[model samples]
Target: MTQKEPAGSVAAVAGDKSSLLTMDFREKSWIKVQKKDGSVIAEYIGKPGEQRQLEINEPVTIIVGFAPGVTMAFRGNPVDLAPNTVNSVARISLK
Candidate 1:
């Protein structure tokens, strides 16, 4: 017979498991990451055409301030952000 793990016993592991998110800032803008409790985890101001890389964790939120010409990509996938508006990327849970 095969053994089965206990219920709720398998803990979530974050061991070297991360996704690369690259932001190509075409204009000046503020980028930040927050938790569910409204706590800021990471924040920064990106320059024009600046390339930024972030190793993202699970169950977090990403907030981007209004800025035109700013674009983002996760795992080489383009992320669409509205212009001149506050954008929030939430519920980013990675297994």
Candidate 2:
């Protein structure tokens, strides 16, 4: 039987600052995205960020496999947050 990966809240930590105007972090979450046959296609860390500041250790819902982005509360609508040099870790859930 194929083993299914556990799904839950993943925490991403800030790695390094991208630029003077932008911040960046390293994805600490191990996310495996597959197509069919459970074959791993793309694997990356799913983290959320905004502007040039990412509220590290903050709990935010990261929607994966939709677009090259993340989700955030923007004016009562789900917005896609793209990865940028200024992008930083928004939240880190408690254990």
Name every residue pair that clashes in candidate 1.
Answer: none
lDDT of 1 by residue, 1-95 (tens): 95554685333333432356777888787887776677876888888978887765545577676445567776456665653254433233221
lDDT per residue, candidate 2, 24-69, as tens digits?
2233333333433445444455455432233222223332343434
Model 2 stretches astray by more than 4 angstroms: 1-30, 50-95
Report the C-alpha displacement of residue 74, candidate 1, in angstroms.
Answer: 1.0
